[model samples]
Target: MIEDWRQRRAAKRITSGDGRALKRLRWWQLPFRALFYLTLPNGDGRQTEYAVDIPRRIDSEGGKARAHLYLDGRHHAESKLPAAFPVEGGTIEMAISAFGLKRCHYVTTAGAQHRLIPDPRSAEGRRARVEREHPTLSRSISHLSALILLVGVGLNLLQLAEPMSRIPPIAESIGTFESPVRLPIWLNFALAVGAVLGSAERALRLRYGVLDRAGK
Candidate 1:
């Protein structure tokens, strides 16, 4: 229903590519660049490779970032953020959030979705490595990220409720309310920073939710 409509809107954002060769990932670009790959059957007893490239940093003047789709290491197509690049078996979808990439997956015609493999030199790749090499530590870190976001959300809602309840129309209707717990200015700033870091960490693992978006 609604999902189909959203998919159609994303499809309309695609545009033809200029057919440039995909460049190799560079050392300096590791921090601010993300690359992912997917392989699918070509229907000729062979397989084809597809890569998605995205720049992490967004230009203030440009407004939004763009995503590049590569086939066999050559540019095939591209679109702005929240893009959907049609491919042989399905569509490769890419989207970003304020902290980092929140979605990068290949949705097949049959409806199954698979996440693309991150480039070995990229931050996502490193996070995947940590998960593979150290399961216990990885789980601990994942849980911590969730805990931080939970605390941030709780405190933020509490703080916002007090001010929101004081609005003229609301105060007259439901009386004024005061926050149960108020932190110092510095503590509030620290919590805000933690919320950002927590969201960024979840992005590395491709985990995002409505609460995270609301916090941002």
Candidate 2:
């Protein structure tokens, strides 16, 4: 029921495009832009190519991130972040994170989901290549990213608990609490940086979780 509501809400946000040609992904735009493609067969026995283009740093319509949908290279439709653009056989759903895209996929009418193929020159494509060529190393890096986020979440909760426990109402019930592990300011700063990098790395592979999303 909640998913259906979300889809309906997203559907309302889409707007028709002006039919401009989709811009080519430039070398310098790779780090800040994401482009993905999907090909689907039509009832006429022909294939249609759809592309999703996103400029991660750019905002539109009052500071909201936007995504563009292209049909065989021409702009077809657009919507704000967390969008759902209805397509030939399904909907192209997209959402962004502070560091990059958290989600970009095609959800079919029958409920099967497929991630779109990233443009070869983009950061996501590079990460996908690494996974294809070095599965073991890719797995190790993914694991490490998760571990970093977990540690970040744990430390954050511990620090937060100390402050919350100091509140008058809480102190009366639980007494003032002290964090068992307190690191130096420099170490905390380093950990914060690590968390951002870890979250970005996970974003490159389209992996997102609540804890990692907070770090981002």
Candidate 3:
């Protein structure tokens, strides 16, 4: 069984074209090449260091993608890793910086190395999933607020409210605001859309990186 499993995993290869896996496929692809910078309080005034980069995505199972770690352009010795390496669940963390928006993770195990989705949604980020779920009340509120914002924006655009019908005041307000510029037509529409988007974001618990039900 073990040999069969190994053969199956090896067949998929450590990597594919660029993004490796579909989740990773982005406009910008980092080669086996991102560098991580770390400083230790060892304050020998010397910077403690290791080569860290984004984890590799490989097939852990038939056609299933997982992440694995590398260090210093090569994998590093966890044993010798200067006590300074970030540790979590017996695994160290690495981040690829060139792509400001991307994240990476890996684990070293007696069994095969494991890979994971790059963001808060990953199983490692279970807490994030909890936050996204938050509580029913909060989710409801975000949805309701979004709806109200949309309605308000609509009212502004339709000139349905007498006060909003005056363009001069609104134009002046728009010019003065640090927030979104208030255009009677498109601007209001955008705000309404934003309301929905914002609510959706909260609903997804991407806001605080946590999605959990209340009283859970």
Candidate 4:
């Protein structure tokens, strides 16, 4: 029941788009921009292409970014992050995180879900290419990324727990805790940077979870 209400509310947030041609992604924009495409059959049996474009670095004056949806080659609709844009058979769901995109997928009426294809010149596209050309190496790298995030999150939780346990009431109820593993400040900073990169790599593959989101 609650999920249905949330869906209805999201549907209401979608607004029509002005028919503007999408700007080509520039070389400098590769890191800050994300473009995804989905093709589906229209009523007349011709394929209609839909594109979701997000400029991660550019924020509106209100401090929130928007995702633009283009139909064929013209602008179709747009909405804020975590948007649900209605499409031919379902909706295109878009979401972003501090590091990169957390979601860009098509959810179909029959309950199937698929990630949209990334533009060939984008970072995500290069990652996808590696996966295609070196499947084993790609899988190994992905697993390593997950491990890095797990370690980062585990250390963060331990650090948080020690501080929380120091409160007077909490200290009385349970002895103050100390993290067993401690690293130098420089190492900690390095680990933090590594964690961000790992999370970004996972985002390129559309992989996300509580830890990945929290670590970011």
Query: Each model's RMSD to truth, in Å?
Result: 1.7, 1.5, 17.4, 1.6
Residue 195 lDDT (model 1):
86
Question: Model 1: per-residue lDDT, tens digit, 1-216?
Answer: 997897889788777778899898887887689999999999999999999999876646657798989889888887778888889888888888888889999998999999999988888988999999999999999999888888988898899999999999999999999999899999888888888889998998888898688779
Q: Give lDDT for model 4.
A: 0.86
- With a 3 Å backbone cut-off (N, CA, C), the pairs that clash in candidate 1 are none
State the lDDT of candidate 4 residue by residue for 1-216, as single tens digits: 995686787687677989999888777887888988999999897999999998886555546778899999899987777788889999888888887888898999887999999988888888999999999999999998888888887887787788899999999998899988777888778778878988999999988898787786
Candidate that would win on TM-score? 2
Candidate achieving higher TM-score, 2 or 4: 2
TM-score winner, 1 or 2: 2
lDDT, model 3, position 133: 71
Better of 1 and 4 by lDDT: 1
**What do the candidate models score in CA lDDT, each in turn?**
0.88, 0.88, 0.37, 0.86
TM-scores for all candidates: the values are 0.93, 0.94, 0.23, 0.93
Model 2: per-residue Cα lDDT over 38-154, one tens digit each: 999878989999999988765744588889999989999988888998888789999878878889999999999999999988889989999999999999999998888788777
What is the per-residue lDDT of model 3 for residues 1-216, given as tens digits with 9 covering 90 to 100? 994464444444434223221233232433222233332233456543333333334234443223333332234432111111333323343322111213333344444333333234232233345535776755576666555555655554344444443568785665332333336677666665655444444423323221111101
Show where candidate 4 strays beyond 4 Å.
none
Candidate 2 residue runs with Cα over 4 Å from true position: none
